[model samples]
Target: MSIPAAFDYHPAQTVDEALSLLQQYGDDAKILAGGHSLIPAMKLRLAQPEHLVDIGRIQGLSYIKEEQDTIAIGALTTYTQIERSDLLQQYFPLMVECASIIADQQVRNRGTIGGSIAHADPAGDMPGVILALKGEIVVQGPGGKRTIAADDFILGAFETALEPDEIVIELRFARPPAHTGSAYQKLANQASHYAIVGSAVVLTLDANKTCTAASVVITGASMKTERSRAVEQALIGKQLDTATITDAASHAADELELVSDIHGSEEYRKQMASVIVRRTINSALERIS
Candidate 1:
């Protein structure tokens, strides 16, 4: 049996206390939420923090609420919560679509969105979805609270712009305008179910069905979720149809350096990137009335 390295455990009941623990432990500590990823990494000896700060018990950190202009979700909100949220189903079905397929029901029930984003795994689905929506992540540290644009938050594989003491507190997205639709599509690993290539699209169309604004983000093809300006530019001002979407998807991952592993080559992943982007765009456009 794989055994994790011994570490001191600190359970925090409040965000402030969690912050204090983080500040005290610094780089030697890791925040434990959901524990789906971290615990396995620990068992594999991939992560060996000296202190484990348990924030799973922190109150008021797990919620999904609709604000006046945005949807504000507490950091600790679970995948199951997001998958079942009526507001997300109605306003941002893309999130629900992605969330419903993450791992399995048990993992979805326990895995928190904040932990997933903070981990910044290349195969993660939420990062691309959030990026496509032009969302923001709220994080708190000893210095104070700050908001990070989703595009700027993720730096590389297994990396983020978060500081050692920073704790992600919430994620927010401006409510998409009328005529806007979004969707996510991924080709995942058969065993682990992690994305091999994931694409997310958000588009707003005018009365004539011409795209006014468009955002496309691709994941698992590269180190971080990547925004494809080429795809967006191709779709904007154009009437989206099979041909236009296919042409635009050909530009997905054109600028980013793709990842290659034992499972697939860089060229294979890039090709799949385009394929997923095309499918997601088509799915999103069909969602519009």
Candidate 2:
């Protein structure tokens, strides 16, 4: 295996210290969180940062808490924590479901939600779930902290709206309303376990079971994880049934420029998008009380 190029390492004890080191090192520095993504890229020599600012030692960056109407997750919280969180299972089980299927035991134990989203791999599971849940990414920079909606956070594959100096601090999602339900489904690559086609859906139904609101997001099939507005528009105000879901799922790839890769062809992914979206929406509908 190829080894990473020589680089300086800096361990940060606080967020401010990490920020300062980033500014000091400028473009030569890369923040090291869980190192699941960065280390592998480094090993392949795909990423050759001259300096690595290690924030793994930073205290108080890992937690899961409920605040009023929101669920707050610290940036450093690992996927394993999320997968096992009783609070998340009770409130937003889709997140737990999505987290549970990401990679395997060892990766989940070390891969962080923040780092995963920050890397913004189009195939990453959390981005689709966050988009469907309408979560907000809270980031801190040299100036201060700011929040970006998941809809606007991811720009494209391996890209985000975050500034070079910013550090993701927390992710926040509104507590789902009483009649709301959500689900995520994906066709994962065998070796890396990345999504080949993934769908995440959130639905809010009225007492009579008519869809009040809907959010449908697709990942891995495109250049970025994005909301399928066509699917969402088709579902809202309609009763979710076999016929309704089947028709709506047909639009899963509408307006999406599907990507063709070694894992699958664009045509195959388009077809699977519909299939996965149908299953995912059905799963969410079944979860609604």
Candidate 3:
């Protein structure tokens, strides 16, 4: 299908150039990173940006760096890059776990981290996974750079806290504490490239085999990927036992207003959320057990 005839395209070779175009076009222009999200939106006539500032050709933005306390992944890092990164595999296996289930090989080859976050699809997997780890997104705009917590950064489905002139630089996450393990599980729709529901669980176990801390973030619900505080509260300070897992999973939908489409109804999604939460928690506990 062809895009709307009224649209204009602007290819950019530098971040500065993209920012300049964004500033010039204001709400009339949309930034195009991988074109995975925007192209489809344009085709559906859901969005009609007068101009698109393309940043796909920009270089030196894709990298995975392991530092003293955290890992920094550049914005343009593709799902394939993340799924194949040995450094990520060694330290952040849950990220690789999530990345591997994203779409298919072809979409993974071109879709990017920044594009994913900025697209802010409520059903996207990375939002919940990164939120569970309490990651930060570094963004640069006319005012220079600043870091925003993942929770606060994603405002809603298909929306973010980014200004028109700003672009996400990278994502930073703390290295998992020793003996800690994590997992991501999702019920994906067939051939649609969207997660019906995705849950990321991070677990920390003490020397005596107790659950010291836990972060459970779930996406594809009513809101953007947000920590299930109720679930985390139930698990923290307890042993990662079957009883605890069952109890915590029940709290996964404490106050959420689930949305429904062709995939499921609100009630059906609520049930799946409980199932995915339990599965993620159990799967992660097994690794460190």
List the candidates ranked by lDDT, beginning with the highest. Answer: 2, 1, 3
Can you give the TM-score per candidate against the true fold? 0.98, 0.99, 0.96
lDDT of 3 at 53: 86
In TM-score terms, candidate 1 sits at 0.98
lDDT of 2 by residue, 1-289 (tens): 5799999999999999999998999999999999988999999999999999999888998999999999999999999999999999999999999999999999999999899889998998998998999999999999999999999999998999999899998999999989999999999999998999999999999998999999999989999999999999999999988999999999999889899988999999999999999999999999998
Model 3 lDDT per residue over 158-263, tens place: 7789887899989999888887889998888887767777789999999988888898988886666678899999998898779889999998988676888888
lDDT of 3 at 6: 79
- Identify the superior model by TM-score, candidate 1 or candidate 2: 2
lDDT of each: 0.91, 0.94, 0.87
Which regions of candidate 2 deviate over 4 angstroms?
none
Locate the minimum summed-lDDT window of 10 residues in model 2: 113-122
Task: List, residue by residue over 1-104, the lDDT tens digit for candidate 1.
Answer: 38999999999999999999998888899999999999999999999999999999999999999889999999999999999999999888989999998988
lDDT value for model 1: 0.91
Off by more than 4 A, model 3: none
